[model samples]
Target: MKKILVIEDEEFVRENILELLDSEGLEVFGAENGRIGVDLAQQQQPDLILCDVMMPELDGYGVLTTLRQDSILATIPFIFLTAKAAKVDFRQGMELGADDYLTKPFTRAELLGAIASRLKKQEAVQEHYNTEIQQAKDRLSYLAHHDSLTELPNRLSLQELFKQVQPQDDNYQEVLAVLFVGLDRFSKINDNLGSDFGDSLLKAVAIRLKACVDDQDIVARINADQFTVILAKRNHKKDAADVAQSILTSISKIFVVAAQEVFITASIGLAFYRRDSIELQQLLSYAKKAMLQAKQQGGNQYQFYTATFHIISVDYLNLETSLRHALEREELVVYYQPQVDLKTGKISGAEALLRWHHPQRGIIKPDKFIPIAEETGLIIPIGEWVLQAACKQTKIWQDAGFHCLRVAVNLSGRQFSQIDLSQKILQILRETGFHPQHIDLELTESMLVSNTEVAIRRLKTLKSLGMQIAVDDFGTGYSSLSYLQEFPFDILKIDRCFVRNITANPHNAAITEAIIQIAKTLELKLIAEGVETEAELNFVCRHNCDLMQGYLFSEPVPPQEFEKLLFSGKNLQFSPKQDHEAKVR
Candidate 1:
């Protein structure tokens, strides 16, 4: 029921107004003065307010002004009750934001008509605003769940759809398979034809993919040039494979885009459900790995996830378990690679790379185990150990008078996600007695893209604590020049891929040169990684690269061996032939 508040100094007039409103089916409330009326309006949230123009302590104009300042109360219909019918008085009340003015001795019709008109107008305005709000919300929801380029459901929508179709009971049975499809050499097409052409091609691909699927199945775009098909009610593995082959055939057909006949082939990876219970993300990963395997074999092919993949999955689990014990077993070690200043060929710093010495496996590279550690969330503790060990080593170097060299430690994405990451590093610094300036934290571009605002804030905190930040694997990820401008970074390490092929591939060389120019323009220290050859070293040096780290100097070694290099002094020069021979060995 609607509510109305009546405020008047005269007791008879206030009671009469309340009685009239009550008779009209409104829940009526009364206050003797403007202050009490404001309180009543707030508490009851009345649909309309009838107040006297003159009252003790506060007047009708004063009440109107005060209510206008409040967002909630400002919208309430207010009609002032005044003794004078003068034009000046009506003008004053309306100027104060009163909805309408009713003179004293006014008939009941005038009061009722004013209230009715104001309430109707308020209802219309509110309805319009609500409609606009809902439309905006719907648009946002659609954008969130769909790919903007192809107008296909995105990963988020895929997850939601999977949840909707997923069985409630654990023992429920259904034949379903997820097929991960990726266009081979799509980047080449994009690079050659341009992004607009690429977008059109992707849209065309989406339509073809959708056409290949049944009405009961779902097709979604998960990544750039990557799409996923959910084949529900497939009877067996063969059925899924047949669907995959059909999709491959459909996508491999020629398409005339922009008056050019473009022929493209796709790789398909199929992972079945009900055969093994798996989470949505894990299933997607399996399919993606299978797709990559298919691509490796050659495009226009399909590969079903096999036992070999399952063995790798089991191996990952075992590795995670082994890593948890690695720190306790003293199997985890920090290996240091010296960073040489290209200008002076002097040791300026070193990066602390993590390694694991398995009892049976002998030695395991980080690439094989780091992803497992990250997936299992073991990187948090493992990262802490790395930070502590690296800091202690830096302190040891400082105590031995190697004060000019800093140590860089790579921080995993999980570690950076910690809310207290800065505080934890500070605690480590205090415990190890290492100067904050002597340590640098290396992060990849992927880490910065997920929660950029939070990453920036956390990085700024670390910077304030005197810790250096470096963007590792610089050109390999989705990092843009804007990232460099917005993020607080002290160094950019050119990824090994570019440096390794720089001499043979002009494109790689051009990218390396562009990175060098960017680093120079930003005044950030540039370090070229994987510099294995004398020619690569000379190329970087000629470009005025700030620092260099690769086998050309020394492979990452244990702390004791690195200490020997430190003792040999900062300018531990070696001939190009000698460095190349060492790299070969």
Candidate 2:
């Protein structure tokens, strides 16, 4: 029910008005003076207010002016009930923001009709504003999930699409294929012509590519020079191969971009998974890797991704048993891989990688045992040890003159899930005498997706302590663009799979460049992993990548070797003349 407040100096007028409104089924309030009416309005926040024009300590004009100053009460519909109905009095009330004026001794119909008209108009205005707000929200959501140039579904949209098309039954065999198509040497077009031409070419390609697939099939532009398609149908092995060939042939034809005839070829990779279980991300990764292989084999072809599965042997029991003691015996060691700053071509920081040296096994990679440690809940302790060690090493280097160098240490999923993770790291920092600013913690994308609220809270706590955070192997997991926008990350590390052959293979180059653009747009630091050649270095530098790490600089090495490089003042020898000459001119 609507609420109405009546303010009049005369007891009869106020009481009679309240009784009439009450009989009309409205919750009613009455006050003998304007002062009491203001107090009641503040308390009850009435829908509409009726006041006497000339009476009481505070008259109708004063009350309306005062209430209009309040943000909450400013929009309330107000009507003045007055014995004086002169032209000047009506003008004064209207100028004070009154909704309507009801002369004294008026009919009951006049009072109720004024209130009804004001309330109806107010509701219509509110509905219009609400609709505008909803429309703006929808537009923002669409822009967040789509590519601006081609207006095609991007990585985040692709992830949501996968969820809808996922196989339902666990026991029934399902066949799904992911095809990654990369335009070979496509960057040459941008370099020779311009970005406008390149953008037009990509838009044209998006149109033709969509025409090649059925309505049920999914097609999306995953990167600048790459497109991904999903064939979510049973018995799709042969059909997958045919689709790849069709896309390759379709993309190779000439295109009229900017009224200029342009020709391009695509190298397609087909990865089909036929099993009772499904992993969409894994299939996409395989297709990308296979596309790189196709590009390596001279391009203009399609390659089927093949995998070798290893049978589980009984050796894991002993390995697990040995890992329990590995930490205690000091068999685990930390290695430092230099992260080179592309702007200065100098070592700016190092990522601390953990390694194990078993007496019988010689050396063991982290991938072989990290999963085991995670499964057994051993990663919490080991991860803490690594953080402490990395921090202490960073302090040592800082004392030795590399004052600006920071150390990045990876945090495992198990360690990050702990409730007191931030407290534990803060304690380690205090114990190691290391400043939180000089150490960076790296986390995988999967670790943050499970419990976003918890992850955001923990990340905020760590950030409050002045520590930097990075997202490691970014493209390897299904991280949405909104996720990146929500998380407080200082850096984004491109996965090796996206950085391989970035210079010669358009597939990797396109993904690598797109990641760089995202980092730039978000104002986050970027690090390209696995940049192994001068060509790769040039590719990233030409696009203004912030940092890079790979064998081209130095692999993850023992502390002694890393110290020697630090002492020797070894810096990357590179020149930016080739990349920046045009801009400089």
Q: Per-residue lDDT for 223-248 in model 2, tens only? A: 87999998877465777788888888
For each candidate in turn, give its C-alpha RMSD to the true structure in angstroms: 17.2, 13.2
Mark the regions of model 2 whose C-alpha exceeds 4 Å error after superposition: 32-39, 53-62, 83-96, 171-174, 234-236, 274-277, 308-418, 421-585
Q: Model 1: per-residue lDDT, tens digit, 87-188?
A: 999998888888888887899898888889999998999898677545533443554577756888888689878887666777656678888999999999
- Backbone clashes in model 2, listed as residue pairs: none
lDDT of 1 at 371: 89
Residue 552, model 2: lDDT of 77
Cα-based lDDT for every prediction: 0.83, 0.83
Task: State each candidate's clash count.
Answer: 0, 0
